[model samples]
Structures are given as C-alpha cells and as structure tokens.
Target: TICGLFGFELDNFERAEVQKATRRLLEHEKRFLERGLRNFLIYKDMFLKSVYRAGLPEILIYLPIIESGCSPRARSRAGAVGLWQLMPSTAYDYHLRIDYWVDERKDPVKSTEAALKYLKRLFGYYGNWELALAAYNAGPANINRAIAMGKTRDYWILRKRGVLSRETSWYIPRFYAIVRIAENPAEFDLNIENAGKKFTFQVLELEKSLSIRELCRRAGIPYSEIRFLNPELRRAITPPGRRYNLKIPAGSLAPFLSAYHGIKKEYIEDVAVYTVRSGDTIGEIAERFGTSPSLIKLINGLRGSLIYAGQELVIPVKEGGLINKVPIRNNFRNYSSLISSSIRYTIRRGDTLWDIAKRYRIEMEVLLALNGIGYNEVLMPGNEILIPVNPLLSP
Candidate 1:
C-alpha cells in the first residue's frame, strides 16, 4: 500500500491503470531513452520514499518519467517545470522560489518534496488515486467541479467531457502503463539495473555567493556536474540574497568545505547586468532581459514610461551574477557592438536540455559546455543555469 505524506492509503484500481499506461509510454520512448539510467535509479529511491510517506499510489512514480523522463532541466510548453511539472505559481505556493538567480521548482529534490506534499493533500480530499491524479493534472477545483457535474467519480467519464486537454486525458493511461512496466520490466524488453544503489552526496552551507565555474574550479568537479547537481541556481553564480545548501559528492565535501573557508565570501562574483538602449521599448527591453515586458515593468519602477537613450535601467536577469574585475589582458578586447549577454533560465518540471538547446537554436554541445554538463546529465527544476548570447533566435 502506498502511503501519502499526510498518511493516507492508496489501494485503488486507479494505481494499476496508471502503471499500465506509463509502461506503454516508456516502451514507445525507448528510442529517445538513452543513458542517465544511473541517476534515474538513484532518484527512484527518493521518489519511492516520498511516495511511501505521502501514501500516494506507486503508480504515481511514473509521473516523473512522463513529465521529464527524470531530467532535472525539463520544461514544458505550459511553463510547468521539474520532475513533477509544477508551474511557477504552484511551486511558489509550496515554498519554491523563482527569482533572478534561482528557481527551486527545477531542483529534483525540492520539486519532489513539493509534488509529494501536493499529492498527499489531493489524496486527503478524495481518497481515490484516479481523482487525486486528475487533480494533479488539473487543479483540485477542476476535479471537484467535474465530480459535482458528472454525478460520477469515474475519471474516464470526466475525460470524455472534452474540457481536459488531450495530454491530460492520456496522462492517466500513461501513468498506469509506466507503473505496470516498472513492476515487472523483465517481462518487457526492459532490463533494469542499479535499483537499490545509493547516490552519495554531502551538504555545504553557503554564505557567500559563488558561480558554478568557481565551485567547479575549487571542487575539481566538472562544471557541468555542479550544474546538474544544483539546477536551482539560475545563474552560474549563487546570489547573496539567498543562502544555498549546496550538495557535493560525498567524499568531496570535506575538501570543498575546507577550500570554501579559505575563500572570502566577498570574493564571489556578481551577475552581470545590461543597460537599456536609447529608443528601446519594453518589448525590446523584455527581450534584452529574457523575460516578459510585464516582468520588466514590475522589476524596474516603470509605469510603462517611455524609455530614453542613455537610460541606465537595471536588467532583471537570472543565473551568474556580475563578473569579478579581471586585470585587463593586453591581448583581449571588446569589439562586438551587439547587445549580447547571458540569461539564466530556471529548470522547470518539463524541460529538457535538448528542448532548451532547440529553443535557443544553440548547438547541444555548446550549451552543455556553457553550463558545465555532460551529454547525459540531469536537468532538475529549481536549478539555475546560464544561457549565453543567441539573439538571432531570441523570441
């Protein structure tokens, strides 16, 4: 019996169905499924523990597989992010902050905690796996109204109302398929391994802000690995506004902590900011900020006022902060006149590196190198990463 965080029981046929659907989807995606199995296996333990505590159905485990294929940097078209595909509002309501420097909704551990907490509450209300699952897709209010209007508790009946998106309608079935396959993968062509292996990590309390590049330099870990481990850091640098509990590979923590103590907090870099140009409208400014005009207006004290030339407007950006002043090298010079800078995108529930690369029209390898990740690294939501200049593909 699956236990929800709030201590409820999930023993309904809904669990079985969701499992079956998830398995089918996994089979279908076998072509795209390659590598990262080790990380997925490690994450599975986290998933099971949370689900067991929440009294959620085991079938719900498959939700992440569909939502992000266990990728931490996964994002969705609807702006949902992370393994649980949480929207910014939902993540915020659950105490996941999305800011210029970090978005915790993409952090695998953080997102899983939020998602399990939400699932538990949904189960508390309905005591049915299918209904709770529906609520997970469409908010609880939507499911409650459907229950009241249809005069039935059947998920399929509500699914036929044509109100739910096609994805939502099929979502439940997919969940079931995955659960079914996970239960007995050997029966299928799937060969499961590393089911019980533990992922080793140690926590470091951060006081000063630092970039992943610097951390990588100190920890002797690949920059990409640090990015994968802390996707919630929207910038390559962590900001002073928030205290971060950085996780490092188990044995590396001692060395990292020792080196971190020697490094002064003030030595940490700040994220770079871009000033608005003359005749630049909010739309252009938004593009420059890599955010919407509304967000820009909200950030800067602008009442949609006309922007003037030489106005030094602070650009609201995410990811690494300003670069520390480096001694000018005689060979190096700034020649490009284009407005080029980096944007930090918080990994959300449904984001993938490939999707991110495609969205920015950047080569996959270049993006991976920029963020310090390998080809098969996980992109958890709530993690912050730097996006280098690619204005030609900017939207």
Candidate 2:
C-alpha cells in the first residue's frame, strides 16, 4: 500500500501490527496525536525544506513529531534533545555543537540537518526504511547484532524471529501508523489543516555578548517570544567573545535594529556561585537557576549526569533572573575553586538506602541515583557505597 508513497518502501503498510498501532493512536492517545500534529503543522514549511534539501523522503518530517511531538526543546531523561531527540554522542558524531552557551541539539535547523544526515546514514546501512527506523530507536549496534543472530536483513523477519528488542520491534509499526494517519487524516477523525499558521522567525547576527533579557527589552519583544524563537541558547546570555546568531520574531527586524543601536553595549553578566547541596540533582539545580542541566554540566565540566553535594557550580545568571524555587545557599566560590569530594561507606548488614540517606542528610533518591541502584535494590553487605562528603555541608 505504500507503493509510490515516498520514493521508498521497506515493508507492507497494511500489517495488523501497524493497524493496531494506528488504532492505539486514534482511540487511546488521540490527544497526544492531535497536539503533536498541531506542532508538526506549525513547523511544516521549515521541516519540508530541510527534508528536500537533504534529498530525503517527505514522510521523514513525521519522525520528529513521533520523537518529540515537534517540540524544539524536548529532551529525554537520557539526555537526547530537541525535535529530533538526538543523544549527545550521536549529536557529536553528526558535528552538532553541544557546549556551555549553546546546544545545537535544541536548534531546529541544526538538529534537523544532523538528524536527517543520521537517518540517511542509517538507511544506507540497512538499505531498508523499516530497519533504519528500528535502528534509530535502538542503536545500529543493537540492530547489527540482531541481524547477525537472526541471519536476516529483513526487519520483519528478524522481529518475527525474536532477535530484535521489544522496543525496536514495536517502533517501526508505530512509525508506519503515524505516517499512514498523516497521509489520510480524515480516516482517523483528525485534520492536519488545523495545525495553524506557519511559525515565522528572523535571524540576527551579533558580534558581542548580550543577555536575552536585555535584547527583549530593547527590541520591544516579549521574553517568552524570544525564548521560544531561540530555544538553543542554554543560558539567557549569548556565547561570550564570539560572533553569535540569534533568532527573533519574524518582521521585527526594523524595530530590533533601531533599538539595538540605541541600547548601550553590554558584556556577559557575572555568574552566581552555588554549592551543590545534599539531595541536589543537576536537573533540579538547573530548574532553580532558570538554566538547563546541559548548561550546568558544560559550566562545571561534568561529563556525567551525577552531581554530588559540596560540588561548586557557576550558575549563569542575568541580574536577578534566576527562578527562586529553592532557598539556595550561595557558596560564592569562583568557578576555579569548584571542587567535588566523596568518601566510600561499606554497606553493613541490615543497612538500608533510606537509613543511610537519612544519616547523610541527603534524599534516598539521590543515593540511588548516585550509585546507579534500582528502587528495590537489596543492599549487599561489604559492598562499598559512594557517599558524597563536602566540608561545607552540615553534619
């Protein structure tokens, strides 16, 4: 049924699995489908152009709809980001920049380009769209192992042989279902034309550092508008000491240029020092500081998701811009003075995570996250547990 659909056909489109997935979307998850389609239609033009320029299939644009609900800033807990939901490693592999001031994974244009390139590569590797879709959800390494184990190149055959992960086995069918519904929305009791007007924006190139708050003030634009237009900026401020490109609302160039020239030049604002507290997570700290976990990690030179108590972090802030959800204590240590120290505590018989967390004045979840333990973890005696010990932290 997908014949002459999108310049490629890797499987039968009318499979019962695909039909069940479609029914699941239309009957059980219609709200999400509607919302996701609304966002997809908003960026339809931009997404189409990207697909065309990359010489990819038109149906490819729907991938982001399924991946991120077409939200430019959507991120997974595993650190995949943007409309395409690219993991940091994959983003880096595609030459998408992920740094302190900006994460290109959140940039609509850059991330789309990177995602299309990745998809093309995967498609080329498998020579089948269904397999490529499966590989995208579960990495190619997993797919390769599945192929070798099953002695098959066909995705469905490998799926039938139970050589593919349950997630991957279901992924392609769900994708096919989305594509089918998108092709003929009327059959699904949905309408694509209702997605609304085009999302419009203009890019401005700047030579000096500037905070988004100041820019919005000068240009007479709403802070939320600017943030929506430029979701890739990790902080309110632009990259220091570099020529940066920022996006603003469409047709606001005249006012922005006039206002920009009149406003006094400014530099990056001073950073606020924060001492990581007991039970602190990078995500919680980022939410408190009006920044992102990616930004916090970049600033602190942290390579992983874990942050221990007593670690000093430099919070990127504009004047009084941080969200005050927490009564955060300021350690005031310079970024250069950032330090993290920890001690090992050997688990004793009858020791529990909750008891140990209470003794250390940290949360039980923090202990589990720190040690990568499961919620129902059974402590083994003599096993050493990593307990964060910061000198500045209260006993």
Candidate 3:
C-alpha cells in the first residue's frame, strides 16, 4: 500500500474523492496549502509529539492541517477551536476551561492531549478508523444513524449511499490527500527545513495576577512572544486567586525570574489601587471600577463591607483594563449605552442567549460571533459572557 490511514491500507489513488482533493490542494487551494504548510512546519514537533505519546500514527499530526489549517487560534463558526477544533462542551468534558479568563481550546499541548483522548475513544468504540474519523466530523450519533440506514459499518459505503452529510463525506478524503502530500512533501516541491523542530518553553508558576504586556516589559521580550505561547489568555492577563502555568519563551527564565522578584506584592494589571477617601462607600467604589460591590469585597477578602478612610483597595477595572469594564448588572443603562463598548454579562435565571440578544437588540448571529459561540451553544447561569457594544465588531 502506498498510503495507510489509521489501520486502513489505501492503494486506490484512482478514487474520485481522494484524487479530486489532491488536485484542488495542488491548484485552487495551493495558496491556502502553502500557508498551512508553513504553519505546520512551525508546530510540527508540538503536534507530532502528542500524537506519538498517545501511540497514534505520525500521520495524525496532519489532522490539524485539515481541522484548522494548523493555526492554534483558528475557530469555527460552530465555536469549535484550536488545532483540533474542539467544541466548548467537549473541551469542558475533557477538563479544558473556556471562560472570560481563558479559552484552553487554543492551548496547543493541552488541546492536543484532550483531542487525542477523544479520537482514541472514538476509534476504540467503532473499531474502525474510517468510522471514527467520520464520527469526528459528524457526531457519533450521526455516524451511528448513517451506519444503521446504510446497513454497513463502512464509511465509504455510508458516504456512497448519501447517508453521510456532504461535509463529512469529503472530510476523510481531504484528510487522506493532505496526509499523502505531507508524508512526502518533497514530491510536491514543498520545503520544510525545520519541520521536525519542537516548540520549546520554560514554565513559570505565577502566584499573582499579571498582564502579558507587563510581563513582556519585565522579561524584555515582545508581547507577541508570550502571547504566541499562551493563546489561552482571554484578557492577555493571568487571573488572580489561582496559580497559573505561564509558558515563557524558551531560554528566557533567568531574566524573567530576576525582574519578577523585584515587583511589588499587590502590583497587578486590569485593576486599580485606590485609597478609601472620606465618605467613601463600597457601592461607590464598585461603580467606579465597573464591577460589583460583592466582587470587590470578594477580591479584597472583606467579610463585611466595613472600611475605614485611607484604606487601600484593589478594584478590578473591567472596561479597558482589559476584558471590558462591565457595569454592575442592575445599574445597566439603555441598550445603546450598554452595547457601545465590550461588557461582561452574567447569565441570570431563565435567561437564554436569544432573549439577551433581543434585549440588546443585536442579531443572534452577531451576538454569537462576538462570543465565538454558536446559536445552540449553552449559556449557564452565573457564567460571565462578553458582549460587544459596537455593532460592527465580529468575533
């Protein structure tokens, strides 16, 4: 066999689907292929290492090329994200966090592990890589229904009988075409000199909140460097109240640690340090910070709202400090004012995304795009979501 995928041998290059995808990649999608190929070279080692550790084939590294054009930050309209295109629900099920703080779906290493576990599970259940891969595109339930309707476990049969959706039917062949070309790039005149190089980084345990910009200034590196390594940071800052694993640029540990030690204890970004003035109140402070009094108290560890004048308080500045200065919920103004800038909204009882969209008078599609979610995506109570104040903005 000239090509083998998962456990299936493929000597049938004459198949219309596989050959057609190959030509399209070579011609119409050539530019797209070139871009994805370049990105694949950069992250090749990172993707392949996880595949290897999971005991999967090296060819599986090409899956991301098919899924997201090898971009870690790529996201589908359906809200699937990262190299593996994991949905929010699936990411949550696999212990990946997607929130106002971070979306771990964009984390290369972590998402790879979670995705590989899922693929392994699918393969194990179906006992056929083709079926598993088909299920990966269309959900398992769809694949199951396809199998039952077609009266066969074979993906090609289901695809041939139109039991599989158009997208799912093409997904496998596109994947195969990509793998065949990638397995021997030289044959296609593709040059990837550092394709085998690994993505190396030194992990720094951050105990307090720090913005990417401040960290970059301290580490003497570009903000893009740290951001490139940590795509999960939603606000470009590590959250407080937990220790975060921050991946710094490879070989920058010495300088980063040196600058980090001299920083003040309470110094953090996305927050304002205020000295309580005479006649000051928690409600006043909260309003000024675009946050709730409860959040301010919780953050400062205040049991009751008893405070003396001249006491320093850390007030989270939401709007530009960076996630959006979300006004305390009840005091929200008219939709025009509220939707003019980014704001964080906590889902209240009996609230649906559509209802919120109606309240804001924003299109449901626009609202979903702003949050990088689908119309059908779940909105749980107490979960904070970002809302775009500007009508022209898209996620």
TM-score winner among the candidates? 3
- Report residue 68 deviation for candidate 1 (angstroms): 1.5
Off by over 4 Å in 2: 1-7, 191-195, 268-395
Candidate 1 residue lDDT tens string, 83-175: 778865466557675555456777878899898888778877887667788889878877777778777787777776655567767777765
Question: Candidate 2: minimum summed lDDT over ten consecutive residues — where?
Answer: 330-339
lDDT scores for all predictions? 0.61, 0.72, 0.73
Instruction: For candidate 3, write residues 273-304 as lDDT tens digits.
Output: 56799999999887766667866765565779
Task: State the lDDT of candidate 2 residue by residue for 77-141, as single tens digits.
Answer: 44467999886557656766554456678888889899999999998888888888888998999
**Alpha-carbon TM-score of each model against the true structure:** 0.62, 0.69, 0.71
* Candidate number with the higher TM-score (1 or 3): 3
What is residue 241's positional error in candidate 2, in angstroms?
2.1
